[model samples]
Every structure is written in C-alpha cells, then in structure tokens.
Target chain A: MEKITSLADLKRIKEQVQSKIKLREQSASAEKLVQIRVGMATCGIASGAKETMSFLIEETEHQAIDAVITQTGCMGYCYAEPTVEVTLPGRQPVIFGHVNRERAREIIDRYIIKGELIDGMIPVNFKTIDE
Target chain B: MKTIADHILDIVQNSTRAGANLIEIIVVEDRKRNLYVVEIQDNGAGMSPEVLKQATNPFFTSRKTRKVGLGLSLLKQNAEQAGGGLQLFSAPGKGTTVQATFQFDHLDRPAPGDLAEVFLLAAIGHDKVRFCYRHTTGSGSFSIDTAELAETLGEVSLAVGEVRRAVAELIQNNLEAIGATR
Candidate 1:
C-alpha cells in the first residue's frame, strides 16, 4: 500500500472507508445491529480497557455476530475503569463495569448472543433532560 | 497525565477527533543531547491561525461539549515542568504537528507509560485510520505502520485478540531492543 502523505490523500482514503461503512449500515437495519461503546479515557486505558475492547471485538467477530464497536471517552465512571456500554436493538443501553477479558467473553455469550443479562450490570442512575 | 505515553494517547485523540485519517507519532531519545522528544503529526482538519494561537490555552476550545480543553495545555505544562518546551504548528488546510521535548534525565519527567498498550489501542480503535509509530533511541530505531500491517494481515482485523497481542508484543520487544522501553 502507498503511504498516505498529504491531507488530500488522507481525506480521499477516509471517504472511501466511510462510504464502505455507510453501505454496510444501509444493508442492515441500524436497530438490529448491536452497538458497543468502550470507555477509553486515560483512566480506562490505565485499567486495561484496551484489552477488554480487543477481547470484545474479537469474540463478537469470531462468533459471527454483527456489531459496531466504538471507543468513547470517560463515562464518568472512574471507579469502573474498563466500562462497556452495550445497546441491543430496541432495548435500553446497559453499561457494564470492571470488564476484563473473561467478563468480555461472558458478555458476548450471554448478553450479546443469547440476550440474557448477566452480572456486572451498572444500573442507570441519571437521566438526560430529554428523558 | 501520569506518563508521556498517556499524553501521547490524549494528543492523538485530539487528532482523531479533528478528522485525521493519518497520524504519526514519533518518540526520539537523544542521550548525547540529553533530550527526549515526543512528536505527533496528523493530517487532520488543521486549525486556523487564530485557533492555533490559543491552542494551548486551557480556556479556549472549539468543542461545544466541553468548556475547557486541557489536553494540549496540560501536555505543555508537563513538558515545561520537565525542563523542556512544546511547539505546535498548524495551517487551516495543511496539518498539525505537536513536538514536546523533555530533559533526558529530569527527575520530574515521568516515564513513557505502557507504550505498547497505547499503540495497540490507537491501531485497533481507529482501524480505518492509518497510524505510524516510530521510536528512536541513540542506538537504534523501530517503526510500525498500520497500512503495511493491514497488507500483511490480509483479512484479519487488528482488533482481533491475537493480532492485538502480537502487535503489542512487537512494539514492546522493539522498544526494549532499542533501549527505549520504560
């Protein structure tokens, strides 16, 4: 592959990748695909969020589950450093705390694939104004 | 915040958020000159002259989601506290480069923390974005480019556990080989 040297080249590649993602999204209902957000702030990274994120991504893909994994900054849960928020189709988003590689695998097998809630669920305590 | 690697990760996040598709992070340790440098360059939506002027001001921010943008300012503080300084260059359509240097053995300078983890996170989190990381010491240097890795991996995603582990190990091993690991 050619090295991306300039901003123009970078923008061109970004457009191509974005279009591919758009096509993928268009092919499937957004609500049907699982959405996962991993906390990756300084605190989260210090606590092994990167490892948790890698595990989640790999396990989900290995299981042939269609999902979108995104990295987000702190969710203000410093106590729970490696936090993960999972949003199933039409259900409310559920946040998990202290997620390690093992917890990640369990989340995938139970919560994600089987739609069964397991341990480590952090209850939604606050609400936005829209709520 | 606690280590140079932490600051690198924070600064790279700024680049990614600024619409950068390609980011380069370079760490050079010149023992003879007694300087340790961390430079991050990105082809992002570069800032305007006015914005660049205040880029290091903690109170100035372009994001509406937060009132204070302290990443750059804090990095500057960290560099200055360690007997070094920071320089930022940017143009509206060009790109941004942040270079920070510290005294090689400054007592206040924190070690580069968990760099392999930092590299792995950046590569896997922004799989579409190309990241090039270079670590140089007085003796030798090691560099990794994600684009090249992608070509080698064929269809495997870097987010895969095995891939991430391998990449991290590569980074750690190379850094150690060059006597740059902390």
Candidate 2:
C-alpha cells in the first residue's frame, strides 16, 4: 500500500478495507467478535500501556484475528497496571495484569487463539453493584 | 510520566473521564525560544476553585477507585524539574485546560517519545470523543482533527485496522515534515 500523505489517501484506503470487512461476517457484529480492552489511565500509562495496546492492535491485525481493541480507565488494579481485559465471544471478560509487549504476545497466542487460560490472570473476585 | 507523549496520553484519559467530547492536544517545539510546550484543553466538566487547588496534590483524586491521582502532579513535577512550570485554567461550567512548559534543551527534559502512536491510541481508546492533535516546530506545523478525518472517510471508522495504521502514518509523516523530534 502506498504511504498515507493526506485525507484523500485515507479515503481511498478506507474503500479497499471496507470491502474486506464486508467479507468477514464475524467482524460485522461487535459482540460476536473478540474484545480486547487495555487500561489506559494514569497508572496504566506509567506502566507502559501504550506499547501493550499498540502491540495488541498490530498483533491481532497481523494475524487477521477479528478483534476489537480499545482503551479503558483504571479497573482499580493500579498495582498491577497495564492490565488487559480480554473477552471471547459469548464468554465472560477475563483480565490479565502487568502486561508488557511479550505478555501481550502470549495473550494473543495462548488465550485468544488457543482458548487456553494462562497464569497471571486477575481473578474477577468481586461483583459490581449492578450484579 | 517518562515521556511527554506518555503524559499526554495519560492526561487525555483524564479529559475523557471528565466527560469531554472534544479534547485538543497541542505540542510546540521551539528550539529558538528554548521551550517545549504540551497543552491539553478539554470541553469537559470543569473544576471549581477548591477542587482545582488540590488537583496537583498527588494524594487527591476525585475518583473513588483509588486515593491518589498522580497525573497532574507528575506532569507538574516533570515540568518544574525541566526548568518550566504547569498551569491550569478552569471554571465550573466552562471546561479545563492544562498547559505545561519545559526548557527545550534542558538536560533534565524527557524525550518526546512516540507522538504518532499517542495520537493513534488516544483516538482509538476514546472513540466517542473527538481528539485534535496539533504539533508545531520552528520549521512548520501540522494539525489533525478526528472529526474532520471521520468526515473525510465518510462512514469508515478510524479504529479499523487499516485505517488506524494509515492514520498513524499520516501523523508520523506530517510530524516528520514539520521537523518534530521523536
């Protein structure tokens, strides 16, 4: 692909990608796709959440995994910042703490791809008031 | 904390949390003036005088999730240590603006870090909020508003993988053209 220099270039690329997205029906409904949420609050940023989030986005896209990667505020896990919450389709969200680039790779390989839970997952022990 | 980009990402998160729909991040690199400035202005729920007084206190945070709010405090310290200062302007219903200045050539100054990445992630994380990033150097300047980009792309979302990468490239290339460091 050519280097994006202006909005016109962006618009042209969007047309191409839109066609690809249409082919992937799984990517159509956001809930059915994988959801990766990275904590991006002050605590998470200080612990390098930006790199982890970038790695997650790049890794997933590179592997062609239909996933939604986003940023969230602190999950009250300031001690174990750079935390990531991954939710598979129709599954409960599981959070992993202290995520670096390497750890994020492991997440894509083990948990996301293979469906095998890994260590270092912050167990969701408490219930919210809504629950 | 470590880099001005990191602080920018963190501070922007605060803006989103404060209910801002439009957040503007401005970075100025002025070697001639010996100044590097990072300013984040938000159209969020603004702060009152009493709350603003304690905003820089490391131990004070408005959220119940944690006791300490080190975002502003850390930025303030980083600015002062680098021979500059931090200022905040806000009114109850007006909004908030955070501006921190540093001596551009100070030995204690932190690197700019990955500014393009910051813009990408900031836009991705807060999809509902529109972010505007303006970077200026002595040579030239570039500014991008997410709303405008979204309009240009029509219905395509910026978070799309290909679009996101393109957006990053757009920012990185523009910053380079303007002679921004890192």
Candidate 3:
C-alpha cells in the first residue's frame, strides 16, 4: 500500500478507527496491562513486520504477560519499522526501532516487567509541541 | 538445522517480510509416492522482474538496512540439496508463489516443521491479514481459514487468548493425527 500523504488522507484512514477501536475494546482493559502496537503500514510489512509481530505475540502470551497486542497504520516512520510502541499501565509510551524477536523478548523481560530501558531506542530529537 | 517445522516457520516469516497480507501455506505428504510437497502463496506487492531474476542470488536484496537477503535463497538451496527442487513465480502487483517438493527418502530432506505453531503465530501476528493453511497427510487433512473464523466470531479478535489457543490446538491435534500413521 502507498503512504497516506495528507491530512485528508489521514482523515479517510481514521474513518475505520472507530470500528477498530470497538474491536479492541472487547478485550483490552487497563489492569497493569501491556499494550503493544505494531507499526503495520505497508512499509512495516515489507520490513518483516508480520513475523516480528507474530514472535512478540507468541512470546508474550507464552510468558503470560498481561499484554494486548494490536496493529496501527503507518506513523510516518517507515524507516524505523517494523517499529513497536509499548505502553505499560500508568506509564508513558516508548517507541522502539527495528524490532525483531530477540529484542521483543528483551522488552518483555526488562522493559515491561522491570521497567528498565534496553538499547535499540530511536532517540527522540524533537520536543513535542505540547511540551 | 532444526526440524522441518522450524524451517517452515522461518520461510513463512519471509513471506510476511515480502509484504504479503494474504498467505496460503499447503503441506502434503504422500506416502505411496514417497513424496512431500509444500507450497506457500502470498498476495503481496511482488518483486519486479529484475528482483525476481536476482531473488536467488542472495546478494540482490532490496533491503536498505541489510546487505543481503538470504531467506529465499537459503530455502531454495536447502530444497535442491535434499533431492527436491524449488520454484518461484511473482508479478508486480499480483503476488508470489513458492513451491518446493522433496523425495521423502532423501538424506537431506528435513523433518516435518512445526506447522501447528506456525498457524498459531500467524493467527496472532497478522490478525487482519487472512491465512488459509491446509495440511494433508496420507490419511487425512486439516484446514484453517482465518477469514472464516473472523466472520464467525463477530467483534472478537483472533488475538484473544481463547481464540489463539483454539487455533493452535486445532493445528496441533491434526498434525499429531497425521504423524500417528507413521
């Protein structure tokens, strides 16, 4: 799939967000929950996102992490894909770059479980407008 | 090398790497003919002719981060080394098909890969994408269509624990039955 370039395109894409949110709501609950969002735009897939996502889900479930894994369309970070955004309950979200199975496990064990920051982070260079 | 199950997992992982949203994996073990065939089909943006020509070259990957793409090349080599052969067909917007056949008795033929886990992984990984996988041994066959399951389950996602377990168990039990015959 091609990139959704403009705000109009983003709006068109957001049209499906409601239904997707509904689907997600059926299971996802915030109880020390681990929320994993895989960057699933076409670029991510080309970069092996599917396999990475699968490995993460299997390993997380195998270890019985309180995780809810889901996919979101591009975040304009194609170069950083197959990217992953992890959010622990009551904590800020962190984005990780070039995620694979090995790194995924590390994230689960250290970051999710112990709240330690492992390497492989794509540094945040820009301060948010809100900040 | 691990079992054929591991190889299948690795290869199927490559299919997702190729941007395939729809993947169909078929495995057939024919005892009478003493042959085994595995086919992986995907509806993804396919390789261009130039890339297709060099797909087996190992050094000709389009990946910007990696120096080489070895997945398909390695799979092709493994198949050929085992007295079987590999065939790949692709078109730019159409999709790709990879088929490998092996003589069951060959020394290098790998053992059956962990297909059960493969389906489970796929069902969870690409819940939005559809995976239609079927396995047929000499005695019987097992098939799973995620699209069908999604339609049946209503708003519930396949990523849910119970659903993923059911799909995983279904593949495992069917595979166990097939293995029982031999």
Best by DockQ: 2
Clashes of each: 0, 0, 4
Q: Label model 2 with its docking quality class.
A: medium
True contacts kept of 2: 0.75
Which of candidates 1 and 2 reaches a greater DockQ? 2
Write down the TM-score for model 2. 0.92
Q: Which runs of model 2 end up more than 4 angstroms from their true locations?
A: A1-3, A23-26, A125-131
lDDT of 3 by residue, B51-158 (tens): 889988877766554455565676777788888888889889888888888888788887775576657655665566788888888778877677776655556556
List CA RMSD, all candidates: 7.5, 2.4, 11.0
Model 3, position B12, has a per-residue lDDT of 58
| Candidate 2 lDDT over residue span A23-66, tens digit each | 44434587778988898889999898988998998898788888
Model 3 clash pairs are: B4-B113, B5-B112, B5-B113, B5-B114
- For candidate 1, list the clashing residue pairs, or say none: none
lDDT of candidate 2 at residue B11, scale 0 to 100: 91
- In model 1 chain A, where is the ten-residue run with the lowest total lDDT? A2-11
**lDDT of each candidate versus the true structure:** 0.78, 0.87, 0.68
Q: Once superposed on the true structure, which residue ranges of model 1 sit more than 4 Å away at CA?
A: A1-33, A41-68, A73-83, A89-131
- How big is the positional error of residue B162 in model 3, measured in Å on the Cα after superposition? 3.4
After superposing the true interface residues, what Cα RMSD does each candidate give?
Answer: 9.1, 2.7, 14.9
